[model samples]
Target: MEIFIVVLILLLSIVISNILSRLIPFVPVPLIQITFGIILGVLPTGIHMPLEPELFMVLFIAPLLYNDGKMTSREELWKIKSPVFLMSFGLVLATVLIVGYIIHFMIPDIPLSASFALAAILSPTDAVAVSSLSERIHLPEKIMTLLEGEALTNDASGLVAFKFAIAATVTGVFSFANAALSFFVIAVGGFLVGAVLALIIARLTAFIRRLGLEDATFHVLMQIISPFVIYLVSEELGLSGILAVVSGGIVYSLQSDYSEPIISKLKFVSRSTWSVLIFIINGLVFLILGLQIPDVMSVIFRDDTISNFKVLMYIVVISIVLILLRFIWVYSLWNEKWSVNESIEENPNRFLNSLLTSLAGVRGAITLAGAFSIPFYLENGQYFPQRDIIIFISAGVILLTIFIASFVLPLLVKNKNIEADKNSSKLNQQALKSVMNAAIRLINDETNQENKLAASSLINVCEKIKNDNPIDKEDIKLTIEDRKIEKDIFLLGIRAERKEVRRLLSDNKIPPATYEKIDNSLTKVENCLSKPPIIETLNRMDSIKNFISKFLKKQLNVNPINIKDIKKIKVLTSKAAIYAIKEQINDTNKKASLAVIDHYNDIIRRLTTFTIGEDINNVNKQRSKLHLKALQAERDQVQSLLQNNEINRETALKLRNFINYMEATAIEEQSF
Candidate 1:
């Protein structure tokens, strides 16, 4: 009951924070959640959420890092590989050493090894937090990409360095050669493990699909566990788990996700699942961060509290060192001996770009997680040196860097616009015109009315695209506004698609009954003609959602529950789940008609369109037969498998691909 209540409170806090962020656009959702988490801790209820280091790392950060790697475009990253390395490894090492020395000097009582551990904790930048900040500011694309790319690899690098530092502190030993060799072993070993694991999983995915054990539930389960699996395996081998997860994610991207997706629904839900889960995880991490202060103070410092005033001074100075070291490193090396950043270096605003990138190095959840992971006791079993103070100082660094980076980053980059090469736009326009001209010529030469009509639509779209100026110079403020509006429309976009009727009644919310009048409607929208853009947007959204959902689902173990039932109960995809909920709760009369495509059959010398003429309707009436044929085929397949002992009777009974078969038939029957 206590656990349930705590969960409810946390959920409510997140909900409230989301609402407040939408209502009050100025403040980020994370800042609000942090405040709430801190306040919740101070409440007299004596409730404190357990934020065990192992649980947080394995459960939260691994998936987050994996998602980051999987989403990254290998080609793009390769293009900027040099700068990314310079920033990730070169910048990280510099910050760790410099900041370590600064903190050590600030308080002579703190050991250099402990100071380096703190340095490691503060080394990695939070790409998500940087992105949120840059949304408000117009940092150059190159700069933002540099920051993001650096962030993807630096967490592993920093964490690896942190391990060595911690080991040094624990055993009171220091050897540069050993440390360097260990770094090579840990980093390289982790990459191999992650890469091998990802490949094995990719092969396993095919086997799972072949066994007919593919569904959304399985997809969600696989996604949730893959990171932990990678992390745990690496750690068990005494390798860097962080590196393993990162390597696996990037490898997965190159190997699997980039393929043309078949399952639209799975793809959609997979994206939503990761996005929402990562969001919640990060938010809770910050909140949990705030909650730890009270615990650390009461438990570790009960007899002798650290000097808060001196600690505050240390935080400010160390943060300055962390920020300044990057500036110096980038400034000296950005153009000095580098071809990767040649264009960026030659840019007039190069220094400003460098400055923003340096300042945007905000320590985030993983930083705090690293700090918290420091064991309470050393080898002697007395106590880890200055453990509580390290946590406190690390917390201060996170807070300062986050605020300065979020607020100050925008100010620094104000009025600065980053763009691609000038020839890029010209090349794009040339490509568009080249295609549009061919399409128009084909339409003009064709004798078929359907072809001409389709050609005309394509021409109009091209003209509109050219006229409306589809490509806009990257404008941060305007871009954010557009995103917000698009988000709004998406959330409120789809129509009330359910209709409860046979001959007389209308109740969208009620279940279908034999005696009672019952009618079911798929997704529908009103005024599609008038709101053509919105309709197009809605269609594109649905198709993407469908493809992604199906793709992700097919990679998982087959679940007993049907997709419709899974969708109704909360789905793993929070966005889709929300939409489903809205549909379930709302009662409205919504009707839809498909975009009647008039396809021309050259051999038959006739135009076939759905519901256009009596003959056309008759021609399209084959849809039902096609649907039935697919169903019968599924039935036969399931029976054959059961007879062959390939599947148990229990599993055979639940083999439901009827929905997919029907959808495929609908698509097939639409052809001329």
Candidate 2:
């Protein structure tokens, strides 16, 4: 139970970090989570949860790497394959050899193999730490892609090195040939296993969907579970679980079928789930890292194993060595105008790009986790030499690298010139036209009066923006009036549609999965409605009240609320009072009926529109303007609910991401 509570605290650490990141943009998220985790570690209930090597590799590293592979464009990775693979494999191997020698030299008592293991632990550059660069900076696409690819693959390479190093340390012997052979088998076997698992899942999922058995709940659960399954299986097969997960994710991503609307909706849900899950995992990784450090500290300081000051010095020296070697290696590779992408001329500033790449090598949670997992005792039963010291030094290097990447990387980017995306404007224009075409199609195909009215209005608005055709003032007003009518009728349509879905479910015409998917959309729309039903009713009631008051003041010569009938209602058990109340009600009802009649009867000349729902636009502008705003509005509603703690984080992120994709579509449409 204490372990469970400690786990919850770590999860809370993730939440606290996100809120803190918003407050302190200068401090990176990893630091914030880690700092808070440290604070949590000091509490009375603080439970030490040390990571075991197998568990850390499976639970934390595998899924993260797999997701990284899934998100990364295979085409982009291929283009930068030479650089990325070299960095992932060759650079990792080189770092292990050099850092092993350096650490051994710094502390002669530490065995050479143990030093190599320490080096391997710190080899993988953290992708999560540098993820924001794509959103924050207009870095050369190729450079970012190369770095990301290295991040995805380097863990496997580092783990391979670590495996060999640990074996040498345990057995008191080393073999270059055996190490090389093991590395090849592990890497190759892991990839193949992942691919095979992914293919099986793809076929199974598609079959399930075809049979209409693929509920969004099930789809999302399977996706989240598959990485773990792949990892464990690969490990059982004497392969790298990290590589297996990565390959499975990438393969499954490519193999996925989201052709059906229901399937597509489920896919959206899964993506959103993954996004939020990733965020929490990222937070936990760093936060738990901070928690583990104190335990490492206890081990180091409990006995006079090494001077704390000397340990700090070793950390500083080792971190410097790692950074300098990577920078020198990357710098050496950038002589000519390297061509990765034809459209993106990223090689113009080769020197600067290399500098940025080198600086971006931030060590992260993986390093710390690996350090913690170092065995306390070797195979011979003697204590593992310098285990505590290795952990302390690794922690120091992680912090130093993160600080450099967070603080210094931005400054380097700031020095570079940023160019406007000329191509973006052209893309936006194309998107506007597509919306225009969609509008035209809607107008032409739909028999409904409201859709046509909204579509026509959208077309006119789009034409004016495009300078293609000018619409008359009368037509514009009528279109706007049509939209107002559509808003008024939208709820009625929603209720009716909901009734139909329920009816189908009761009659067994549709499967529960289908019902669920459709009903979920309906519920989301209902939850996200800007105005509640009662509010709309109250708005109408207010109008009715005002109309009655005006009529009484002008025609009956009395204030409506203060009239004799209304005043008599205050008398208890009076027949006249009851009669008066009835009269007041009748009068109010009459006025409301008259006002509603007037509202709908107002003739908008030469206008046609859908009253049930307004098509915000029939033109290209709809994508960027009206429809885009609607998507944002729905997401905003979800966000507000999430902020008020009305919905769970999982639900909030799922809804927000679905809306987000629509917004992205709009942005993309406009871009093209």
Off by over 4 Å in 1: 131-138, 211-216, 257-265, 294-305, 336-348, 418-672
Model 2: per-residue Cα lDDT over 40-91, one tens digit each: 7767877567667568767877777778878777887886788888899999
Cand. 1 TM to true fold:
0.64
Which parts of model 2 have CA positions greater than 4 angstroms off?
Answer: 1-4, 132-138, 257-262, 301-305, 335-347, 417-630, 633-672
**RMSD to true structure for each model, in Å:** 14.9, 14.8
Error in Å for residue 256 of model 1: 2.3
lDDT for each candidate structure: 0.60, 0.64
lDDT of 1 by residue, 1-672 (tens): 988888788877877876786576466556677778778887888458757777888877788778877766576677778989888888778878888888888877779998888888889997556644543444554565667678878888898888889999999888999988988898889989998998788678767867787697786677668888999999999988888988899877676655444544455456557767766776666677667657655554454556656667877988888888888887777752222343333444557666877887888877878888898888888698788788877777888888787677756654442333443344334333433343343333331443444445445744654444323323321122143332233223222112112211233332333112111112322222123234546755766876676577577643323323222211112233234434533222111010010110221222322224544443344433333333443444444333222332333422322223223324333322
Which 10 residues in a row give candidate 2 its minimum summed lDDT? 564-573
| Candidate 2, position 641, lDDT | 40
